[model samples]
Target chain A: MARERKFSLNEVFQHTKQLLLEHGYEGFTFGLLAERLGVSRTAIYKHFENKEEVITAYMVDEMEQVFAKFVHIHDYPTFDEQFRFLLNLILYHDDLHRMIAIGRRIPDTTPAVRANKERLEQFHERMYEELNQLVERGKQEGRIKPHLPNRIVLAYIFQSVVVPHFPGISLDQWAESIKEIIMYGVMTGN
Target chain B: MARERKFSLNEVFQHTKQLLLEHGYEGFTFGLLAERLGVSRTAIYKHFENKEEVITAYMVDEMEQVFAKFVHIHDYPTFDEQFRFLLNLILYHDDLHRMIAIGRRIPDTTPAVRANKERLEQFHERMYEELNQLVERGKQEGRIKPHLPNRIVLAYIFQSVVVPHFPGISLDQWAESIKEIIMYGVMTGN
Candidate 1:
C-alpha cells in the first residue's frame, strides 16, 4: 500500500502567500513550495499544473476573502463610520495591493490561469463598485468635497495602502493618523 | 574619408529617458539608443563602454537640473509660498519618481557607473534635506500638524507625483487641487 500524503488547502494557500510575497512572481516555484509544504512534488502536482495556476488560485482566494468582508461596509450606520471601517480593512490587507500588482504580471499560459485571471478582474470591478457607493454616500452627506472627481478621491484612499511604516508607531496609530490625514490633511487650521 | 557622426549630450539624454521609460532598465540597449540617435553603435561606444555608464550619466544630468531649481525654494519667503513652489516643481517633473526608482536598480558594475550612482544618492539626500527644511518651517509657522512624523508628511507629498491624471482637467487645475488636498484634505468642514 502507498503511504498517505495529507495537507489542507489552507496550509497550501498560507505557504503560497508567504512564498509569493518573499520571492515575487518570478522567483515563486513548485520546488520551493513543495519543500515549504512538507510534501512530495507529486502531492503538490496532484492539485496544480504550474506556479501560475497556484498563484492565480491564491489570488482568487484572497479576493474572495477580502470582498466577502467588504460587502458588510453598508452595515456601518454612517459614512464616517463606514470610511473608518474601510480604511481599517484596507490597512489590514496591506499586502493585497502588492498581490494584485503581482497578479497582473502573471501570464495566461493555460486555460486555468486565464480563467482565474478573469475571476480576479471581476473581483477588482466589484471592489471599485463597492468603494463607489461609499464615495456617493459621502457626497450625499456633504462630507467629501463636491468638485473633486470620484476617481481622484478613490485613488487617494487606495494610495494610502502603500504608506511606509514609521518606527515607534503602532498599527492602530498609523491607521488613525492616515484616516485623519485623508479626512483633514496636514493643516492644523483644518 | 569617413563621415562625421555628431550628436549633442542633451539629445542622447533625451533619447535615453524615452527608451528607459518605454522598455525599462532591462530592455534598454545601446543598439536601440543608436537607432534613436540616428548614429552608429560605434558613436555610442565612443562615449561610454556600456549601457550602464550612459544611463548613469543621464540620471546624473537629470538630478543636476532638478536640484538646481530646488535650491531656490528658500527665495519664496513664506512657508505657504514655498510649499506651493515645491509642489509645482515636483508636478512638472512627473517622471522623476519613476526615473529615480530605475536608477536604484542600476548595478554598480564599473567605476564610472559607481561614481554616478553615489552622486545620485547624494542628490537624493540633499533633496530630503531641502524638503525637511520646508517641513520644519511649516511646523514653526503652525501650518503643518506638530505631532506627525516628518517622513510621513514627506511621503504624502512625494506620493502625489504618482497620482493619475484625470481626463479633461488642465494641469494648472490639477496641481491646485492636489495642493489644496495636501493642505486641507478632502474634508469640507476643513
Candidate 2:
C-alpha cells in the first residue's frame, strides 16, 4: 500500500494564504484546503481545529514578514527615499493590501481569533511607533511639516498604499504619480 | 377582511440597501430580505430573479443619487470649495462608500447582472466626465497642478473618502487633517 504524505506547518500557511487571497473569507473551507493540500480532512484538522485558526495563523505569518520590511526603512538616507521605498513595496504587494483591507471583516469571536487580533494590534502599534520616529526625523531634517498631527500624517501614508490603480497606467507611472501627489499637493500655485 | 399591504419598488430598494450595509453581500439573502419587508420570498422573486439583481438595482439607485449631487458642484465659487464640499459629502455618507467597496465582489453572469453593470458604467462615465471638468477648472483657476493627469487627481480624491479613521480621533479632526495633508503635504520647508 502507498504511504500517505505529511505536510509541514509552513506548507499549510503558504497554501492557506493563497486560498484566502484567491477565495476570500467567505469562499474558504477546510475541505477545499485539505483537497488542495493533497491530504485527508482529518489530517488537516489535526493541525487546525477550524478555519479561523488557519486564517489567524496565516495573517500572523504575513504580518511578521511585512513588519520585517520596515526594519530597513532607516537604511535609506532620507525620509523621502524611505517613504518612496515603503510606497513601492506596498503597491507591488497587492495581496497584502487586499488582505489588510479585508482583515477587519474576519469574524473574531473565538479565543484563537482574539489572540490573532491582539497580535495584529501589536504589529500595528509597532508600525505606528516606527512611523512616528520617521516623521520626527523628517521634521528635524526639514522634510515633513511641523504643525501637522503625526496621526493624520500616518493615516495619509497608510492610505496611499491602498489607492486604487487606474486602468491602462503602468505600475511605474502609477507609483510615480502617487508619490508626487502625496509629496506635493495637486494644487499648482500660480 | 382588511386589505393586505403591498411593498412598492422604492421600499424594496431602501430595505435592500439597509440589509447590504448591515450584513454585507455574503449575509444578504432573499429569504431574509422578504422577512424584513414582511413579504414572502415568492413576492421578492416576482420582481428580481436573484440576489445579484436586487444588489445591482440598489447600487443603480444609490449611484444615481450620488451623481445627482455633482450637478451643483459649479454652484460653489471655487474649485477648492467645491472639492471640500464633495469630500465632506463622501466622508459623511459611509453607507455609499461601503456599498461601492462591496459592489465589485458581486457575481454578474446573468443578463440582469450584465444590464446592471452597464448602467453602473454609464453612471461612472458621467461622474468621471464631471470630475474632468472640475479638474480643468482647477487648472485654469490655479488650484490643481497643471502637469498632473486628471485621472491621477481623481484617484487621489476618491481614495481619501475611504481612508481608515484613526482610533480616538473625532471625524472633524480626521477630515481637517486629511485636507491639510492633501493640500499642503507633510513636508516643511523651514
Candidate 3:
C-alpha cells in the first residue's frame, strides 16, 4: 500500500526546480522541498537519500529534456532556420545555464550523485558535439565565413543567452533580435 | 624614522591583484600577501586594517585606471575605430572583470572598504555611460542599426570577453576576430 502512494518523480522535480531557483544550492533543503510539495519529508527520503541526490537527479532530468529537443534541430531545413530554432531553444531553457553551474558545485560524496554527475558531463560533451556539427553544417553550406574557427563561432552563439532580457520585449522578439545580432551584427550593412 | 618603510601601495596592489587571481577572494589572506611581498604583516597593517580594506582599495584603483583610459574613446573619430579601441581596452583589462566580481563579495565591515565599494560602483556606472555614448555615436553616424536597442548591443560587446581563449591564437588576433564578429558577424554577407 505504501508503494502505491502518489509520490511521483515528475512532481518531485517540479518542486526541486522551484526550490533550487529560489534558494540556490546551499539554501535548498529536503524539508523545504517537502513543504513546497505538500508532502512529508519521509516521502521524499523514501525516493532519495539526500538533497544532493534530488538536485543531481533533477539536473540530469533537465539535461535529458534539453538534449531530446536539441536532437530535433535536424528537422529544420537550412542553416538560418536551424540557427533560429537553436536561438529560441536556448532562450527557452535560460534557467538551465544557472542550474548547470549549480550542478558543477554539487559534492560527489554519494555514489548516486557521483554517477549522475558523470552522466551530466557526458551529456555536456554530447551537446558540444551537436553544436560542432551545426557549425560544420553552416560552414559547408557557405553560410558562415570559411576562415572563422568553429570554436569562436560556437562560443559567440552560446554567449547570446547571457545577454539579459530588456524590459517591454516578448521572448519571441528577444530571440529574433539576438538571431539578427548573431547573423549580421548591429551594422546597417551599407 | 618609521616613515622610511619599504612598503608601498603600488607594490601592495600589484601583489594583491596577483594573489586574488591565484587564490580568489576567499583563499587570499594577509599572511600570504606579506610572505609574497617580503614584508612583515605589521608593515602591511599600517596601511590597511584588514583584507577587505586592501581588496576594496585595489579594486577602486583598478577601476580608476580603466576609467582614465576609457575617457579617451573620443580620441578616435570613426564609430568602428572607437569601438575597436574600447574592445581592446576591455580585453586588456580582462582580469579586472574577475577582480571586480571578487570585489563585490567583499564584506562591507569597515568604513574605508565601504567607501571604496561605493566609488567602485560609481566607476561601473560611468563605464556604462561611456558605452551608451559609444552606441549613441554609432547610431547617429548611421554605422550601427538604429532599430537595435543600446542595451542589447552593449551587452553583446561586453559578453565578448567571456569567450574562451582558443589555443595558438594571439591576443591581437583574438581581439580582431571578436571585432569582426561584433561588426559583421560570422556570415559571409553574400
For residue B62, what is the lDDT in candidate 3? 85
What are the per-residue Cα lDDT tens digits for candidate 1 across A141-162? 9999888777777877776776
Could you say which candidate leads in DockQ?
2
lDDT of 3 by residue, A88-108 (tens): 888788787768757877888
State the lDDT of candidate 1 residue by residue for B1-190, as single tens digits. 7665589899999999999877667768899999998889888888898999999999999999999999898898888889989989988898888787678768888899999999999999989998998899899989999887788888777777766677887777777777778778887873
lDDT of 2 by residue, A1-190 (tens): 7555588778888888888766667668898888888888888777677888888878888899888876888789877789777777666665775677657777776788879978987997888898888888878788887777777777677777666777788777778877777777676634
Please provide, for model 3 over B21-96, each residue's C-alpha lDDT reduced to its tens digit, 9 standing for 90 to 100: 6666766899999998898887788889999999999988888888899889889988888988998887787786
Worst 10 residues of 3 chain B by lDDT: B96-105
lDDT of 1 at A57: 92
Q: For candidate 2, list the clashing residue pairs, or say none.
A: A144-B188, A145-B186
Ranking by lDDT: 1, 3, 2
- Residue A26 in candidate 3 has what lDDT? 70
TM agreement with the true structure for every prediction: 0.81, 0.85, 0.78
Candidate with top TM-score is 2
Indicate the fraction of true inter-chain contacts that candidate 2 also forms: 0.62
Error of 1 at B181 (Å): 1.6
DockQ category of candidate 1: acceptable
